[model samples]
Target: MQGKALPGFRDFYPEELALRNHIFAVWRSVARRYGFEEYDGPPLEPLEIYTQKSGEEIVEQLYAFEDKGGRKVALRPEMTPTLARMVGERAQALKKPIRWFAIPQLFRYERQQRGRLREHFQLNMDVIGEAGPAADAEVMAAALDIMRAFGLGPAEVRLRISDRRVVVAKLRHSHHVAADELVPVLAALDKWERAPADSERLLTDALRADRARVRPVLEFMSGLRDGAAELRESAAAEPLNECVQRLGAMGLGPFVEVDFTIVRGLAYYTGIVFELFDQGRSLRAICGGGRYDDLIKAIAGVDLPCVGFGMGDVVLGELLKDRAKQPEAPAQLDAFLVAVSGEDVEPVLKLAHELRDQGVAVEYGLRHAAIRKQLELAAARGAPRAVIVGPDERAASEVVVRDLNAGTEEKVPVARLLNGFFR
Candidate 1:
């Protein structure tokens, strides 16, 4: 039997890897442009990191077990807990408002889906030691900038913004819901758009009330989905207002939409929360994140306000393909060296290494082969040009350069070819 990649996993062939690398390049470029330095941690960590942040329920979705040394560990499902632990270790000595980002391959044990997977790579951008709306706006702007870098625009993607504070305020004041019931209500609200019936049933169960009593709360939440402008009347919207205003000042207003329903479904999001979606709403969130002021303290006993977002490659790759944004695989070689006869093989080897030393991606036949066969290999490898070395040309201190795509050939001085003339 032929072995296969596990379900919900992928095999990144050269072409697919090219697209993944393209996404990663854009992510790193935009993150660095925003002054966020790249960082990484071990892919495997203590199992408690996931369990502590999300509780024991998360263990069911983690690839976890006891190690040979009797230590419980798991492949990290998310990067935030790792970030918190790292930052917390150096909190006092590190400079304020730390800006950091990581590209990690995360693993999860879950059902396979179009966007969701058991294993995937994610771009995690984070800001630590800052608590204000400016930090919120900063991360959001960085995310939008990445989309722009990928040829996505407001017309193609929408940044759905919200704040946990605002949602809690509306739930408590307007509907008089108790603080104790907020968790269950939020769990329902997180799934409200995808499964309204389930959401309502959960909400009703949480409130311990009949459908009639839950109707007003449902209506209130429905109105919030209208847009951000609807929430301005509440003082709880202050932080979100400033964040949106900051985005507006940066000319990113068109990509931003306020919605009170984006509570992020997590208990730790203490402040602003948000998710990015394709304007078509055909896939899961392209990215999602929020402020969690207490996570560092919980994980590492260091209190530092933080805001961040995780943009996974799986869904983003799907979106890019849908929108025709995937980049072509880069040409594998600048030139291929061809030996016309046994005597020319030595010079072909020498010239190949020389061109490579000059920073050109040059390849040549590793073993003796026919000149025609060599040219065929060059074309297959996507080499732009082929440098043909023959006894006559070698004697003249020159070689024939054949353009694979144009099917044109020209004689070039050996010195010129070695000096990056082709490059």
Candidate 2:
């Protein structure tokens, strides 16, 4: 009987692993370019770490249970909680505006979808202890640069920027929606903009305010969609505005879009929020994060203003495939060694190891085999060249190097063959 991976889990065969590695390479490269030092924490942590920020209800969504030691623990579903505690512990010694990034394989007990999965590697890039708007722009620029690294451009993806304070201010001044109803109202707006036909009734009911201060404000809020679509009046929008300008100066203006509706579903975001969405907006958010000023203090018990974003490999991979920007297929062996005679096996083995030691990916059969069969195996292994060692060539301290792709052959002396075959 064959066992299978659980639903929503992945089995990364060679080809799939190639794509995964490509994603990781780009993630690390771009993150390093932004001056973000890589950091990581244990995958399993005390359950209270998450509970401190999200409360007990979050346990239901986590793979949380009691350990054999009778300690409550859970697989980490996100990196922020751990980041908070780690940074909090070193808050004094660490310099301000700390830049760190982590690529963690996170887990959650949730239904799987096109972009959402139970297990996936996420690139979490955050700037901590930085309250200025430039930090916001820096993180956003990092996210966009990752997309650009993979050949995606302005036409393929869009950055929807919003400030939670601006949204609340506009809603309070116009819709008269109470603080108690803010979550639902903002959620409804988020849905209404995406799935208007479905959320029409909910949004209509949400906007139906009996207070006299509501109608005009509701009208104004609704008109925002058609207006300049900029919140120039709010004080909180100033930093957001500065962030946008910084991105513009960095030549990323085309990818930016201001939509006040992006009141990120999370309650922790205190200021600017942004989500990267595909131009079509068909899948889930490609990436999302915002300025969470007090989240560190709340969870880690140390105050640190942080801004960051998490981009999962699953959706980003899918997006890359859709755009035909995925990396080329994994490379094959650099060379295959074939010994023409039983006596030649000794030379073949010796040279194979030397090539391998020199960092060339060379493969050879373990048992005796005919030269034709060896060449066949070399082709099967996708080696573009075969180093053929025969008694005649070995006697002369030379080997026949066959260029399989070009169907050409050359005899190079054994002295130079070790380092010169690949050359």
Candidate 3:
């Protein structure tokens, strides 16, 4: 049998798992602070749930197969479809503006690259049942706060935000792109920055118009990336402007920018799309999402509006390491109990149990060992203190407490030691 993790998966050792836990802690803390409750669905869901929301072509990226029950299923690649289904099942019974978040391990059968794996854990935060810019601002705030919790600020990360309505309006009125051809044009625009010539060809083909018409559209799109397109006063840009204003009022203005180039490339995104990127742009997007007003209706026959984002751990962890924000693993033990002689072993065990019961992280050798050997083990485990129960100290109802780091020692009464002294 092969003795390694699958190409795009990971094996989180203690240190790696600690980092993962730290990321998750920050995610939960910020979500709760924003009054967003955590929720999760089955890791494996009906395949149609995804195809229904994103079309049949998405099957190319799914970990899908037929099960023994003769039903088609797939490991979830994203959380939005499941969120819509869960919300729709009891939409009327739930309160307005449902706030929910989830940390799910998502799978996708795709090529791996820097900051991208076939499988990864992602934090998904969504606001449902609200259709206004307030919901949009709320979701964006939560995402930004999580980045802040990780010792990141606007200078380290940037939020590029846009509104599909604004982009569509520009295409219709200025570029003369027809409604029937919007989808392909949007897809081509998504590729514009990465492959300008190819994207231009795609745009030319999708528009089926004169080559002359495509140049104006390309120039307009270029201006959006170069900080030359100024559409803030346009009516279609109102919702995005309001969202940016809300973020600004909350003092998150420095982290945000009105970049029309960020269309999110998702067909379901109807308005206010945003992506979080490292300021250096050294990796893939750390997060991306937007409002999908008709997605719930399309997937579950419910007309609730929703906004959310998915932040993956792969790119996020890479960014943290690059920015020197990775966290250290917590100490394994608070104290190590040592027995000086055979006679003191029982006292050492008793004191170890008492300290542990009092909420101290205590550890000791499972069997008898020399005092020096036990202290060495304690040091290896990064225990800060070692409690030595010697014959004389045990007789005097005391123990010698040694600070491993400072190399200091003191005699403490057993009674004082048991009463939450170590903690």
Candidate 4:
């Protein structure tokens, strides 16, 4: 019986794998340069750990079940909760200001669409145990640096910066909304830009009892722009203003803007928040993060200030394609050994293995194909040079080296071939 694969999931062919590896290599290089230690967690974790931090709303969006032992578990939807649990487990002994990063295959049960899937990879970067606004700026700068590394300029993407503290402060000071009611209110306000006018009004009314209290909330909502001047005048705009100036002083202001409408949907975010958006607004957030100063203590029972962000491989890949930057060139192998006839196969395989042992990526022609066909295959497989082991070469203990690009060939003794080809 033939079976079809599920939607929103994909199998990576060799070509696709090469592209994925190339993208990941760039990510790793930039992450290391910024001093983030690589980290990872189990693909599955206790269901309660996610539910505890993400709330019941996440249950509908997660692939969760009970094992045979009746222990509840779920595929990890995100890595922050796992990071918190891991750090909490060793909170007492671990040093402060832990800088960590991970690229994990995350799964979600939500419906799939452009730039999203039931399963995808995400790069998570976090800085733990630093609470100051500078810490927030540093995280933002790191994210911006990654985008710039991918060739995204200020015109291509902008970091929409906001502050949950400013949102909370506005709700409490301007609207007199109780602390208990703030989360839902902010969740509603987060969609104010996209929601219908009536729907936004209904949400605003639910948060504020008096029309006077609601005025500032509406004004703050209206003041959402790409400038700092208007943001400073709004009641719910202080934290965002502070963030703007900090990023500006660091010369990162050009890449960022104040957008009070960018209330991140995550519940744990407690301070500065931002989301990177394509200039066209043609897709969802390319990356996003915020301060979660209470997260470490909430999970590990130890107080620590932390900020970080996650960039999914899917959306960024789309953006890269849109920008015409997806790499078309495959990685090259050092050499492909072409065996001209059946009798030449063993020697060809032996030479390939020897080259591999010396740290060269080498492939041997498995089938006894024609010399022309073998060379074509080598070129197609992105081998820069081809080593021809014909009957004459085998008898003379020599190999013919051909540069595919330069279209040049030379004969060298077997003893000197390795160094000759490599050097």
Those runs of model 3 whose alpha carbons end farther than 4 Å from true positions after fitting are 227-229
lDDT (C-alpha) at residue 384 in model 2:
88
TM-score of each: 0.94, 0.93, 0.96, 0.89
Question: Model-by-model lDDT, in order?
Answer: 0.90, 0.85, 0.89, 0.81
lDDT of 4 by residue, 3-87 (tens): 6568888788876676678678878888898888998999999898888876888889899999899998999999988898888
- Model 1 stretches astray by more than 4 angstroms: 210-212, 367-370
Model 3 residue 232 CA deviation in Å = 1.3
Q: Model 2: per-residue lDDT, tens digit, 1-423?
A: 588899789999987898999999999999999898999999999999888767899998999999999999999999999998899999999988899999999999998888888999999999999898899999999999999999999999999898878777767765567887777667666665668654545555665644464355445546555652456567757888899999999999999988776767557888888999999887788999889999899887888899999999999989988888988775478888999989888888888888888888999988879888999999888888898999889889898889998999998888887756566
lDDT of 1 by residue, 123-210 (tens): 9998999889999999999999999999999999999888888878878887888989989888888879879899988989998976
Model 3 gets an lDDT of 0.89
A best-first ranking of the candidates according to their TM-score comes to 3, 1, 2, 4
Error of 1 at 233 (Å): 2.2
Higher-lDDT candidate among 3 and 4? Answer: 3
Tell how far residue 78 is off in model 4, in angstroms. 1.7
Clashes of 1: 0
